[model samples]
Target: ANRLLKALFLVKYVDTFKATPRNLTVLVYDRFGLDLTGLGKQVQEALNLLEAQSYVQRNGNVYEYLTNEEQEIEKEIKAVDVDSAEVSSKLFRYLSSDILKTNKLKYAKNGQDFSFGYKLDDVPQGNQRELTIHFITPETSYSDSEIAAQSMGRDELRVFLGRDKRLLADLRLLLKTERYTKQRTNSGATPSMQAILQSKQVLNADREKELIERLRQAVGKAQLIINAAEIPSSSQDAVTRVSDGFQELVSRTHTNLGLLGGKVYPEQQVAGAVQSETGLFDAATLSALNSPGTEMESWIITQTGLGEKVTIKKIVDRFETKPYGWDLGSIEVVLGWLVGNGKVALSVDSNPVVRTEVTDLIRNTGKHPHVVVAPQKAYDHAKVAAFKKFCTDFFDEGAVPSDPTELARFGKDKLAARRDELNALVSSSRYPFVSQLAGVVALLDEVVGKQVDWYLTDFNKADELLEAKEDLIDPIKSFLNGQQAKIFDETQALLNTNAGNLGYLPTGSADTVKALLADANAFRGNKMNQLKTAADTLRGQIDDIVTDKRAEVTAAIDDRRAEILGSTYYANATPAAQESAIRRIDSILARLGGETQAALILQTGATFEQDDYPELLSRLVEAQQGGDDDAPPPKPMVSVKSISVPDASGVLESQADVDTYLAKYRAALVATLNDGKRITL
Candidate 1:
């Protein structure tokens, strides 16, 4: 018990002075006059016992002294080192003040008496004698108190008696009862005992109460408070009484008034104990908290704005765990306050109600609920404004916009209008006529080609315009088809008429040949190049018929020539007659050489006879018996003389001789003629 007191005294000494002036053993030996042989072991034992009691904890070689307040089963107050000069000085000043003093003062210099609130006339004379010593009241000291509680343990330290009761009690006693050593002295020597002059007189109940009230007021001004309930009722011996009662209360061992900032622990439970992670209680609590169907479930989604409802349990679960570290009940209270103040809107149907009915009923329902922080309206307005701005810019820039909205608004109508205009332009006649086709091509280039690029991105508009342009083809096609059909029908009719006329041309109709030739000339003269698709075909058919007819006519004319040349009369006739016949055939050929129908007419007119004349009448004297005509014999031939002339010029020399020869020649001729016989001259 004495050792415990010594340890407490040593700790108190170090705490009060902020320095240790001597070693433990030497200090104990000097103060208590103990033998030093085994003092080290005794001191160590005492320190160990103090540590076991949690009165002083050793950190390495340094010891931290715990106050009686820190030794509580539930609450603990650490013995905070008072290294702050301000705190220490302030404590010193308070303890030295008049409230703690129980002493008196008498003072004077020279013949004047020292007085309170002295006037100038009461000033001491110069170089006066020393102030006289005055008797002071005796007071209890903290060492005596410590000795009084020598047998006490933790309970003795529980009640705090301020710095004056703990450390400055001896000083207070010294100031209260001390007196000057010399009877007469100079002012310089008298100043050594000035503490006695500053000492407070014994405080009466009213004075103590007034001082405490002032102290309380000062503490309040400083944002501090004293626990007056811890103060004992006894005035004369209040410290001892409070200390004893606190010790007795602690000794019961079952009462657990928790320490500051800590929960009330069970009796006999050690402080700062470690618990298992998978302990039944903790595991069960975690299981309940983490369960999917539990009330805490989906709370994360709610508070994080991932889901709709913001319930109290969700708020608590979101904040009161992991990073936030708030207690559940504290979060509940905060949410309750918010709901009451209408900062948050909550659903009433939640299992555990968040706020009271009165508070919820008083909330304004007309205003929008502050659910999730968002800017939906602002975003929508901005989007529309941007769209409008883009549209305005697009038009103002002289560019066509191909956005869907722009296309829907303007492109479709523009295309439709363009289509209507094109329809009107081409409606009068077929487009792409030989004369107007170039202009149509230019229009298409200027209109569709220039504007199609703008609507390229808006495919529907492009397709509509393209469809309109495609519609332009139908009219030209229809016109060409009609023209082609007309040309085909006309050509077929011409071919049929010419063929029918040429078919009968073998009958030698001149008009048929003339009309056929006229039609051929017309067909050849009319250029079918400008005609549409069927023109070449019609021309080819007409040309084929003309060629065939010419061939037929040429063959017929050749046959007529052969027939005329091969005739018996032509063969037996004079050259003149044959020449006339040839001239006539040549004339016919010249008239219709290439004219097949005319030549066919000539060929048709000429015919070859089977026989030139019918057989002459039949011969009557066909058969006669041999020698039946013997009685019709003719007379014998008569003899006649003939004159002979020599050959050449010498033979007939004279004219008379020649005359006689002539007469003879005549006579012989007559004789030969009369006798029906040949005469030689």
Candidate 2:
């Protein structure tokens, strides 16, 4: 069997020589008509005989011809005979130079091995499993930093190239031929408009780079302005420029922190901003947000040093260890101490207020919001001063409202002196003045509103400022009835005489439509005052039962003011939660509104807006909707949106066939070459 196979192979080899003259080996000529009868029996026998002879054997080992130098000549013959040559170069170029511009490749003059660009992302796929995509990567991994950058680059590369193996393999060849891979993804003297389409990547890369650099700069600038920065957003457009000029300082800030600044949770952080130590001490306190027994004491114990009596001092000490340590406010310390004590006990404080709080507001309450409403003491003082001035305005220093001649008789020198004296204190001592003036005016308004009441007719008739009398209403109604009767009598007489434009004069004109219809059915309406009286009787009675005006007002003002004190004024916040509530009211009323930034800065303790502001917030969509720059602040409504899913869906796998299969395929194809001989599949 070995001799017959050898003879047949020799016959085929002679045919190849007869067909074309060339210096060739036996394997090259015997490329065709070389297969034995049955692959199992004949190939096995040939392999055994070749092994026994050991004289330039034709076959190797037990496995299929996946690889062997002896067979390489045949693969080369098969590849050329079967395919178009030019398509390979075009596809290869696209894969290498255009699709995956490698970092390592350099010169076009270099050979194939030196030329490169085959992004890891461009590698072909192999194995598959549910929730686990499998791929064969290079045996050696890159440095951690390089790996990170390359990962990003590879991710982007995969996006650019349509993750296809055949395309990338062709691209790898192109990259080798062009010897180009670097910043220039596609570099040519602008290929023909048609060529550019073929290499749109080369054309588009320039734009992409510019765009990327601009994006980086934008993020950098935002960071700079946001960090170590001051926004000159002012009321009245007032500016206090520094020596460097506002723009110059801003540019400096941008250089320092802007371009580097990112989200509070930024992807890449800069070693910038008003510097502070990383070591921070954690503490816990009660919160309004949590329900009774809903919160865990374990969180607090973990944060605070676990011990029997975790004292307030221990927590403070931890924070103080860092340079520029943040001072825990008294209330915070107290709350922390309370919780520490509570933690030591078995039962949790079930009070709504004592639940472990995760918010900042609970720790910093008590600060006041600035407002025009002065303390009651100041109000009373202003009232007292106002009474004397009111009296003096209508009279002489003797305090009389009547006898204007007697008042005029007072000397001009005395009057000027008295006026000057009163005016001087009216503002300085806003006391005994503003309130009393308002009180008198309110009383006047009350009397004017009851004009129809005739219980005090004499007073009303004598002076409009007084209440009406009872008999006055009867006389007025009678007189009005008589006048109405007389006018109708006269009108009937005139109508009978002339009858001018009878149809038009039949009744009232359309112009009186609104007035005619206005109280036509007033008796049918529900008495609005009845509902108000009922409501006020309940709520006001409830308020009255609380018998502590000072406590009520103090608590309200204290809570609001405290909230204001620490406000960052970022669009999303609480207190003056909406644009309407904060700017229109707070800014106008704030003493340092112009100097401050960050919405809450206008309150008290806070200053400028911190990009990473952590103030508790509630939303106010309706109130914020119509707010103008100078409009009053809107009320906030606490709202939230959430999605609950048992599990999040993700790309468990790209359904990818990984690199190992592709490399094996390529190697198998390459190995099939053998001395110019071909193997028909």
Candidate 3:
């Protein structure tokens, strides 16, 4: 199970979206092509095991691989130590340099190998595992410092990559090329577009036969190369940008070819027009008929005069603009107006009642069936100009709507209304500028969405600060401690004074006894009242301190944030640089959280040790306290003789053999763990 799970771990590294369970299943099938007779069930079981072991998190169908955290925890849990107490302490000190979480420390022991492990998690992944220090004892006859140096040297490669610029550059270039090749292969870019189309073309019988044949030959000979551009995965935004560019190209090509093919081929000029015969029209009475092109006159003659019987489709094709036709519904309204105005007579004998104009309508076509009929109707290019202006104005104002959802809703509504207009404009080969409009609108939507998200995040942070509840632990602790000390002293003095007075008083005198009791009662009552008043004042002061500290922390966070935001470098950064800046800001926020948590701990009178910060501890001890930067590095405290994994293969042939081997392994592990000694100052 572990082996299979390890094999499946590659899914985590793939450049796929989300790595959901369904996608994971698909990936396994595609890559391995294993007989999936019942593999889905096996996959589910595997996922269940991983989740149970806390190696991954499955939220709904989405799976987030948690290999890093899992390995880190595993190292911490399995850390074992053996040998003398003095040696163990030195080993722990060595391990402490590696691990961050001091509280994750554990003690264990095993035979021969006296080792201590610590989980290091400075990087994103748990690339750095346990840093173990093996002790050399008299029994083992090994050297201590040698093992320690060996352990540290094991991570030399990683350290070198981080420090050596030239080496890292070479490594990065190699990785980039390898990733590009992998992505190119995975995307199936070679001949993929051609395969996707599968020889499908929009050219029909209406197209020019010779031109269509030529286009077919051209497309067949065309060698398409959909290159998967090399981009660094380290820069996810750049990768996404390249991916989006390819996607946009695919979408634009689809739109152009699918809807505007006929328009592109002039021989099939009316090919883009929809053949709808349902619309009813009367051409005689509408005001549009008188506007231009003898549009109404052409329609009236076609339906009822010397023209042959015509369908709505034919009438629209003849009278309306060519190539891309106008809306059929709008044309119907004009025809209805003509009939109502009694400028044409309707003949009811036809399925579409034929209309005859009051005066005979004639078109001067001369001898040619294909003559220049009417000058192409001029469009208000000014509307396009106005649209551009509107876009510029809208962005320039930069005034956000009160409700975040409102802007989204408005954009959605407007896009829906304009969808037909957009599709029609694009379908007309003449209106190539529509692509620019589409690009602008898409960009606007994306920017607005990002802005909204940013605003909401800011508001949420402010709300959290306002509503947070924190303890005034320092003030309260101080108050209680001071009062307890004072009360103890006063009680001692009262007891002493009473004892002395009692000795001097006459036991037989009733008046004297009564006076003494009254004095004692007065003293007790006065002290109790004073204590109550002091307690109340101290409580109020604690509350005030809590409020003030909250204000102070809030102000500090805000000021630091403002400084970062106001930096000239930040202001001038490109989009990618801005993203990198945001990541740095996230690091700052993490530091702030840690600082606030430490402050709260100190306030509660809990010990907040400087040793908790390994980096800071190094600065304090090694750099500042140790005198100079050029000072010699610290020598290893322990050394390793050999590191080995026990072989169980020969003993695993029989159950008896397995049990015996396990028993010995368990005994060694238990001893190592239990015999671990804590480091003391």
Q: What is the C-alpha lDDT of each candidate?
A: 0.35, 0.29, 0.34
Compute the lDDT for candidate 2: 0.29
Clashes of each: 5, 66, 14
Error of 1 at 88 (Å): 50
Residue 239 shift from truth in candidate 2, angstroms: 43
Regions of candidate 2 where Cα sits further than 4 Å from its true position: 1-163, 170-178, 181-288, 291-297, 303-681
What is the C-alpha local distance difference test score of candidate 1? 0.35
For this target, which candidate reaches the highest lDDT against the unseen true structure? Answer: 1
Error of 3 at 400 (Å): 61
Residue by residue across 1-681, what tens digits does model 3's lDDT show? 353465457665665566655556665675565767577777778887876675764433455565664444323322322223433333234323322223222211101111123222112222232222121222222233332343332311111001222222222222333333344446655474323222112111112233223323322222111221211222123223222332322332223222221211111211111111122322332233333223453555655555455433444454333222222333333333333333332231321122222111211112123211121122244433333333234323343222222233343334344444434544552312233334433433433433322322321222221121112212222323565335434533443434423332245322332333233222222444454444344334444444454455545545544654575434554555555555654554455444423246233221112122122222222222323577665321111111122564454788888788877666655444354411111
Ranking by lDDT: 1, 3, 2
Worst 10 residues of 2 by lDDT: 267-276
Best by TM-score: 1
